[model samples]
Target chain A: MVNNKGLLIVISGPSAVGKGTICKELVKRGIDNLELSVSATTRRPRQGEIDGINYYFKEKEVFEKMIEREDFLEFARVYDNYYGTPKKNVMDKISNGKDVILEIDIQGAKQVKRNYEDGIFIFIMPPSFKELKSRIVKRGTETQKDMDKRMTCAFEEVQQAKYYDYIVVNDDLNSAVEKIYCIIKAEKCRLSRYHIDLSGFKEEL
Target chain B: MVNNKGLLIVISGPSAVGKGTICKELVKRGIDNLELSVSATTRRPRQGEIDGINYYFKEKEVFEKMIEREDFLEFARVYDNYYGTPKKNVMDKISNGKDVILEIDIQGAKQVKRNYEDGIFIFIMPPSFKELKSRIVKRGTETQKDMDKRMTCAFEEVQQAKYYDYIVVNDDLNSAVEKIYCIIKAEKCRLSRYHIDLSGFKEEL
Candidate 1:
């Protein structure tokens, strides 16, 4: 008896909660059967970005069409640009016994939870409100009004943490990574995930 | 905020399935906040057994009265002796922020689940039927008739594994111990367990 399929892991929080960095570290640990889910975007690629490697670039019209056909697991249009996780890419990897992790914002996480309640939903939390504000301020790219808006958004997202299965405080980087890694290992032991073949045990008896 | 109460962890399987061994190893790992729940039994303690260390030796009448008062979390009468887990002992530790683990048989586990569904239930499984039978035979204390009865009981217990939250196979002792350790750590991260003080994170902002 084996777990024939992999788990769908969603890491979510406010924009500056460090979900991206944690996911990067987990992937770089060289666990062979784990993968990060890639998103399709309607925005321009950056200088060093590759077409399929960085993001699945699509025209706005084509992205809207895919949304109509439900090709994306979760998608949202933000200030004229569309971003979404393609359903096929994530589903195929899971079927092939590779755990696929998605680092998305609160809205997309809620969408994925609605569609698949069995996936592991983890909410990464900043140590405190002060720390969250400082992280955003350190980026030094936003105006005072914009930073205030982001902090308000972060406050709203922190309230949504209760809905997720696990809440990991992103206080220490190594400790946070270790906790998430433990969560992944523990999920593998869940009885709901395994197709236990007890028939052979009984038959041989 | 901290999780005010500790988790009630139940490790269960058929007799001789190594549930007791795993629990011992986990406690011996010196996780300071973890403790094993001691059972009160009407049977005479073996030579050199301490009163509260190995088992809480109890008189039959006292055990019966306690059961009537709903003092035991779960209890059962086996062959002439009454064995049970005292509710106060386990609950007090949990209230003091120490996780209490119970290593019990399948029937006792069922009773605990009925009383407290929030507890973490883990089932220990042998690698295969052949390995299970050989382990029983190697014990060399049971008669042939008793051995057959125990094997039949084991076969029945395997079917109940589905009802548990996690299933750990005892193929390798170290691996099984490590998996259970990870499970404990992950459970602490569960949203339901933590008294999340997001209120501070919001109010301070």
Candidate 2:
């Protein structure tokens, strides 16, 4: 019952594969018991990005200090910036019985896996690589070379799906969200997660 | 994908814990893709029992012959009657992409586990031992001695919940059914079970 702790859901997928969109839809459903884990990053906040909501924007020195303190669950340097998941916030929420969903890239997901083996790892996938290519192309902002690079990265990411506990294909928006919801509900029912009070049975005996 | 074979869901629990009721609800919900595996038994049919629907009623000779053929996924003899799950029907349905639900006792479930390790095993449980005892006594057919024997058996069966992948408590009938439904839906999205066609990616590469 209340003895069951909340789940740490680590979701990952290649860029343009709708991982962000699915997470948004899941939140929009108003599931009060769950929260999205805010990531800390040394990268500059983009236009319209909120300081805490979009990302916990941090100075390079502050981020490095955090790494020294082992404050991040998982952190990495990409190109010129550092990004990582803060350990305290996620751990506090889970201990307080709030499920936290962390949307990350494959590399960050691997880090999470090593640190938190009990977390549910889900990989969001495109319906087909053809569709994925078209979606990348449809974005207009990315040049052909950029698209190719993204696609190559995606190909490699998909190979890592075998390590995930669940693979959700984002063929349709609603269906994908529904599948994730079901996964959360079902995971809660796992025998290892649920605590059954057998005191009544002991009394009877 | 059609290549994804159906799941063999083995459900078991203590007696009078609402396993039958939950299965009936699951079927009534028009989960057409799933079918119940009809058990073969040598017990005499009750007043309203049908040949195939209720049980595959068979003569003792035929039941013994089935045993000799190694045709049952799991079988057991109780008192003067022989009961078992015929392997062919279940296997055929699974190969054809139809999920099969096998409602059996813990003993039979353990037998099935030895024969089929890939099955999703679920244990249905009562909210508490008090509730379970009340439910058994409410049936009005059991004498005090019968009730004591049943309660003892149920106590023993409850200990086997540790072996199950999922444990659903029948606190509310509808909620229990919904949990099982979600479990099935979520299981289909497992990376191991799902077949993703990456041919498009190969072509792109």
Candidate 3:
């Protein structure tokens, strides 16, 4: 029989490409033995934000120490906030046969790729340029300038999709979620993932 | 939007590993746009076996010449009977957007592997050595010698599983078939399979 380790599913995409929505739907649909990984952040928790649930809220000094010790799989400084995904918790869960999903940004995904070669890097994509622009427009930001800046950043991020292992377009929420779910199941069958012990097998007639 | 090409799925395993049964169940279960490829043979067909349906029956001279011209993807002569898989038909269907599944012997699979680098090579395995032996025994082979030979062949063939990209243990028929099906769906999402055109996308905010 084949004994497989749980996959570290790293999902990212252009800004507002619905990566979070797809992950939520996958969890809601109930994939067997699946878990969402919580990230550690140095930002102060807002109202209703639960530490260790929403994020492992850490002080700047402690977060820096954790980084020095290489406790995080990936961490980034974005607009004065330090965000990171804790490595130990994820690896521990995976060792215990739980597939962990990490919804992170492109920078975080790149770092995870370097730290964990076995992780499944998935890029969630919009159906078209028109659709991507429309989705951003629907957000109704304060100024056209802000929206334009976001759009340029998204274009740069879209190029990063080439680096990912798989790409699923977020045209239909359920379909995209289903594709990711199928990927997980198929990946479990991959030869690289399993320690198949044929030692128990005999050549007896 | 992403445009994916059809995949060439080559399924093989040790003798009596039930690769045929798995492929049959997959076709019966109706995966979208899936087709089974028919092989060609120099041996005469049995009663009720239709030419071009069961196989592309051919003359010895013709078969040999075809082999010379490299028309077959993989071929072998077993007990003076030549059996081969025609490459053109499979490629045509795949080019037309139909995923093609080929169930062949381990030797033939190896040849296909050399010929088709893009093919999805799947190795089907039994639950255990005991199960493999039991399955061979269930065939009610005429001689203990024959059964022993088959068991030995199966053992040799299983070693080839290491070269495959994926291994599906046929512990349960439905589960195994579903795993292969999921593999197809998941493979469609692979970055290598799609020529994703981001040109159709716009950066407008």
TM-scores, each model vs. reference? 0.94, 0.94, 0.95
Name the best candidate (by lDDT). Answer: 1
Regions of model 1 farther than 4 Å from truth: none
Note the residue pairs that clash in candidate 2.
none
Instruction: Return the clash pairs for model 3, or none.
Output: A129-B201, A129-B202
Estimate, for each residue in B1-205, the C-alpha lDDT of model 3 and write its tens digit: 4554688999998867788899999999888999899999999999999998899999999999999999989999999899999989889988888999999999999999999989999999878767877777787654877776777778778888889999999989989999999999999999988786666555343
- Estimate every model's Cα lDDT from 0 to 1: 0.90, 0.89, 0.87
For every model in order, what is the iRMS? Answer: 1.2, 1.7, 1.9
Name the better of 1 and 3 by lDDT: 1
Candidate 1: C-alpha lDDT = 0.90
Q: How much of the true A–B contact set does each candidate keep?
A: 0.78, 0.77, 0.77
lDDT of 2 by residue, A1-205 (tens): 4255889999899888888989988998987688999999999889999988989999999999999998988999999999899999899999998999999999999999998999999999888888898888777788778877888889988988889999988999999998899999999989889776666786785
Clashes of each: 0, 0, 2
Question: For residues B100-168, what per-residue lDDT tens digits would candidate 2 score against the true structure?
Answer: 999888999999999898899999988888899899888778888888888888888998898999998
Per-residue alpha-carbon lDDT of candidate 1 for residues B1-205, written as tens digits (9 for 90 to 100): 6587888999999887788889999999987598999999999999999999989999999999999999988999999999999989998998998999999999999999988898999999999878888888776788878988888889998899999999999999888988888898899999988787766876776
**Cα shift from native, residue A94, model 3 (Å):** 1.8
Give the candidate order by descending TM-score.
3, 1, 2
Q: Which 10-residue span in candidate 3 chain A carries the lowest summed lDDT?
A: A196-205
